[model samples]
Target: MLLINCPFCGAREEHEFHYGGQAHITRPADPEQVDDKAWADYLYYRKNTLGLQAERWQHSFGCGQWFNALRCSQTHQFKAVYKMGDDAPEGLQ
Candidate 1:
């Protein structure tokens, strides 16, 4: 029974949330000017680390708000949780 903390609604079961892939991926400001390879990289590439990873999750069963979490991929331990637009808590990056 894994639990995830929602920035808006406190801790909730894992089933209450939706995994939204990697976090902090910013879209190109000038998409039309980006090269084909860069575009492909943006669409397909991700830094799949085995240790601590930053990811996005939606608290679907609670507040339905999106937030970011710094988690350990191998252990599933969540280190920090924060709102989507806020800067990550210190010592996370």
Candidate 2:
């Protein structure tokens, strides 16, 4: 079984967590000013990478906290796990 490290709860089985999709996506500063296409893009589009990607995850069955992880999309290896709102480790970007 796959193991995922929760920043607050240590390592746990992957089934105890939930994938929250790509991380670091920014919302429009002024939603009313954004065009329809831009709004749609923000809601529907995400970067799909084959290498290291920053993603959001929730430790649903553990700490019940959200965190970010730098993981390899192709290999599913997690390089680092960090708390929400904290900066990712240097050079992991």
The local distance difference test score of each candidate is 0.90, 0.93
Candidate 1, residue 51: lDDT: 92
Residue pairs with colliding backbones in model 2 are: none
Per-candidate clash tally: 0, 0
| Angstrom error at residue 41, model 2 | 1.6
lDDT of 1 by residue, 14-74 (tens): 9999999999888999999999999998999998999998999998878888899999999
lDDT score, candidate 2, position 36? 99
**Mind giving the per-residue lDDT tens digits that candidate 2 earns over 1-93?**
889999887889999999999988889999999999999999999999999999999999888999999999999999999988888899988
- Residue pairs in candidate 1 whose N, alpha carbon or C atoms collide under 3 angstroms: none
Model 1 spans > 4 angstroms off: none
Best by lDDT, which number?
Answer: 2
In candidate 1, where is summed lDDT lowest over 10 consecutive residues? 84-93
